[model samples]
Target: MRNRAPRSRPLRAVFAALTLVAGTMFGLAVSAPAHALGNGLALTPQMGWNDWNAFGCNVSEALVKQTADIIVSSGMKDAGYQYVNIDDCWMTGSRDGGGNLVPDPAKFPDGISGTAAYVHGKGLKLGIYESAGTATCAGYPGSLNHEQADANSFAAWGVDYLKYDNCNNQGISAQTRYTAMRNALANTGRPIVYSLCNWGQESVWTWGAGVGNSWRTTGDISANYTSMLSIFHSNVSLAQYAGPGGWNDPDMLEVGNGMSFTEDRSELSLWAEMAAPLISGTDLRSATPATLSLYTNKDVVAVDQDSLGKQGTEIASAGGADVLAKPLANGDVAVVLFNENASAQTISTTASAIGISSASSYTLNNLWSHVLTSTTGTISASVPGHGSVMYRVSHGSGSSTGTTHPLIGASSNRCLDVSNGSTTPGTQLEIWDCNGGSNQAYTLTAAGELRTLNGTLCLDANGQGTTAGTKVITWNCNGQSNQKWNVNPDGSISGAQSGLCLDVTGGNVPAGNVNGTLIELWGCNGGANQQWRLG
Candidate 1:
């Protein structure tokens, strides 16, 4: 926890100072939190349902009421799912005569207050969505300059949560815009949980703790394993920032939308392991028993709602097999053995290696199977393809082992090399002859970073650039998204920040694709220049 000074100073001044110091002294784009939002909410990651992924702009009061009814009948409410959030398109395109946001009468015949009353009567809270821009993402009236008026309308409607989005902002800073809404919500004197949805740009997590109960750490998640895996790789590295009051929101859960049952289970397990918000984005009315089982598993949910409030970190990752461990309040660690491959594989880890104190024996409680077993130290399981095996290990310690290998260009058969073997930040990366040198040995870290030179520096996108021609350089590993990479199955290495592939400069042409060619970020084509093999 960071220490705070007197509140006599302005907040923007404080935000600027902290951002500067964090960048200059630590090489980090975000400053550590002085404290999370003091609203006394979101002590645990928020678990609920949001209508966006499944319904989109089709949200209506009837849909929310039906969802709420099903949630209660399906035993989800008793299982700790509380909020029924209505996403965008709930309000009119224009504000009312009094400059207040108006609920679409066609959609909400009884108005928002009536909808909130109906929801509250069912023992669940109501959540609404708005944007901090000139217009909402759907082109509806936004709260950019009418923060107080919009916030007042939400509160007057008895809203308990607000999902503030990012769209159509006319060149304002995220912090300034979000802070204005935070202040407006506070002035309403309502205990509304604030969620910042800025699509993860601007390093929101660094300053998110002081501004909102939760901040998005990535773009919207789709209902597919690839999208979920990419988002997970990006979010798992920033475990140090989440706590009771604020969390790293990786968008919403995509379970029951379209993915297979195995993938759905993996999504739930990983999200719970990371202590992320479990806002369901599926239409619950037609949910299957398997989907409900994955959502209502008390033991798995326990790990997410644990009072420890610690986000899990990757303990071991290699060859598409990864392990994550979250320390629970009861002195047990929740371990997830995930397989990202297309075939079944056995994953293993030791109790002592996961941070548990030495013990005579340890108990492994399988969260999905509800089976209890004893292990002296070794914890292992057979996980199916695109699936996960989670366990609660009592008395354990963990270790991380990253594989160091040369990334060989698939076309030229040359190695990805650090220029002149320099360890300095901003040193260019290139392709060289396949020589077994330390400069050519890159370690893929649990944080999704490619680190070389004994893990001191990372492969970074030049100046956080997202363009096609951004230079790929070596810089100190600072836990920023620009340093994260997704080594995809098709042999393409794409940056988490830009979604651009790492390419060997001029590799498309045989003449310029030779040794000593510099590397860069480019559009992901199936060409050999963008393809790589790690060995």
Candidate 2:
């Protein structure tokens, strides 16, 4: 998420300093809270329904009531699904005489208070939306200048949750915008769960816990598995930021929203594996029983809601198949073996791979099957193509398991050469001095696109250029063969653009002089000159 544009004037010197001190004090208080709302505000991987995906900007009080009814009638509420959140566009064009926010009279004739009353009567918590910026993402009036008024209004309306977004005000720093809302909520004395929606801008994970109950760490999630996986994997490194009173939200769940379920289990398993907020974006009123079953799986929910509050990380992958390993509070490890390939593929992992080795014995509880099996020191299973097998591995002796970084090649010595650094999308590709900057950080998206850390496009040769010295530059992503670059275990990147590896042009040796050196496609010769590490 980008930062909003600054609209308000700067604060006075003393007021600014006091505000900073207040913020620090607030951070300390929240971090060391004696109690969080009720036993901590962290959602064991928040499982609820959000209206954004299905309803978009057309949310209404009747719609929320209807959704709440469906949630209870469909048995999802009984399955530990609690929140019925209204995403965006729930506000009217104007505020009331008392300076309180009013719901859209046409869509929410009973107003927000009535809507909240109805939702509360249904035995469900109510959540609403606002923008930290001047305008909401959906163009509705935001709470940018009306933080206290809106917060008080929400408290009066019995709101239990608030999804505050960062939309139009692009000039304000995320900390300032988030802090304003936090202060407003605190002053209101309402126990509203504050959700900071900054799209991961400005290192939100670094400070989100001090400001909000949950924070979005990625862009909006699509219904497809690839999109969902991309968002989930993007935040793997920030997992440690999540704890008892805060969570890293990877957007909402897309199950049953007309996406393929061939490996829907893999998606759900990965979400649970990451301990991500699991706000369902599907229509509960018309969802299939199978979908409901997926949502109501208690075993998976247990993994997500683990009291330890530890998020999972990727263990390994082959081709498109990958494994994610998460450590539970109970000294058990949750492993999700996923095959994201279009065709069937076998995936297997031993307990040793996830840093678990014992006296030749272990117990595996398959979360989907809700069954248990005893296996030797090595635990291996055949994961179907586009599917996954989620297991909770417990030690036979009930001893605590040690955790190593689960990702393969995570701690490897590799350098990513960003020869031409620019904020622009497409620039000439070249080898440069490695300084471990944002320009050097590359992310292999779940959609198979090699993107810069700031979400810029990574380009390939317009045509297959197998010959050496093929120039590379950024281009709009079309998922072409040339656009894909595979990072091998040895720190060499092979470009799909020409089926050739990225080579340091002419073996440039100097540090800063390598900045403008051209990048070329060459045959893999296993030369140290050609190997580039992703530092």
Candidate 3:
């Protein structure tokens, strides 16, 4: 049974004094490197089980003990579920005389330290919750004014993980608030995995690596197919920022939570493709065999735990059907074909489509089946509506290495300019003669969205096809499929909206008039117009 709030409490003056001291101690600013907080602790995708979706604020010492017991006995521990997290609403109204934060006496009579000891005794790490804002999203006390005190208390309690949320933090820059906690944690000299949960504010991925170990790249995930897919899609553009010690969290796992199986499988596959964390958000004690099987597939888990730590990118989509691909550390590739449509759709993709050379014979491992098969140069699979099929493709026999430049850096020598006066949307984009101009400098975000050095969206031809004459232009940053462009080494740009390569229509080469030339999508012709010099 879920634990509820107590009807009565003892009013204590010591609680007030502890709060005052905590506020006073944290009021002083500390100077340190901003990235110091995430510098310590586990550098891999955190594998854990959180008690929020199943129990919410109704958690108790008994409940935690039962969950911990189940985690140890259920074989999830051997499968890599280590951290047992207690999220939100576990705090008491006050701190103790030792300057240590107290857990709600009714729910945790032994305090947080006792809970940590118990969890550690089970050979699992312990994780606690806090908020950077004045109040948590669930309306509990936050660490806004108690950064140092909270950090000290948490460290003393032997807390191994901290999921710092962003809620009710008004009038404060996220950087400043995060930096404060970071400094506080560093002062304690304890290694804690600081997870910055801000729902991707201020382009968190762009700077999150300099702050926390992981950042929530999207909003909360629900226990349904639509909700899970929506959250997964939202993070597609930010895939590049995920890596060792820094990850783009798509929220906790919904496996074995009584959600639809199709949705659960799709969610698992997509998360694997993105290389996101696999923290289970289900009741381990009552988990069904199917759920356990789904969560324990070592083959699929390998994709999530790939050493390369590179996030996957979407290659193409048609009629709500999309294909996403990620390069693995073993030089193989992982592919996810998703059918977001109302009905089933057959999604097809080639190795070359995802920047890999076509193999004579490829070993295709179906992540869902946990089985492997050999296929020729081409492979196709059918995906159900709101479902996905994930695969690991490797060379079956011979390895053919090809020169592929998936991404290009923008520098003084390699850059090209857009025609002057072509800043508006739908303007034809061309690779002019190389010049170290501001217009030539651009940054490709991990989300695959192209932006000017100052952060303006580089759009595709009305967000559609590879036809000859699709114009490229600049627009405000909106995460539309059309505004996402994948830079290829063949000196061509492909639109995420249509999977069409940016072409110099008809290979036109007049100097100044290259401005109004029609931009179209075409095959990789290796023409001077198709080859762009990235600056």
Error of 1 at 273 (Å): 0.4
lDDT of 3 by residue, 88-118 (tens): 8898755578655678989998888899999
Off by over 4 Å in 3: 1-42, 96-100, 397-535
Can you write out model 1's per-residue Cα lDDT over 1-535, one digit (the tens) per residue? Answer: 0012124323543354356556767876543575557999999999899998898899999999999999999888988899999988898888878998889999999999999999999999999998888888888888999999889989999999999988877768889999999999999999999999977667787789999989887766888999999989878877877999899898899998888767887999999999999999888998855477678778889999999999999989999999999999978999999999988789999987788778988887777644455779998887768888888998433322276888877556678999888978999899998788889988888788999987889999999999998999999899999999977543478999999999887776567667789999999764557767564
Provide the lDDT at 70 for model 3: 85
Candidate 2 C-alpha lDDT tens digits along 59-87? 88878999999989877888777888988
> RMSDs, each prediction?
18.9, 18.7, 21.8
Query: Which ranking of candidates, highest TM-score first?
Result: 1, 2, 3
Worst 10 residues of 1 by lDDT: 1-10
Top-lDDT structure, candidate number:
1
lDDT of 1: 0.84
What's the CA error at residue 220 for candidate 3, in Å? 1.8
Go through the candidates in order and give each one's C-alpha lDDT.
0.84, 0.69, 0.68
**Displacement of the residue 245 alpha carbon in candidate 3, Å:** 0.9
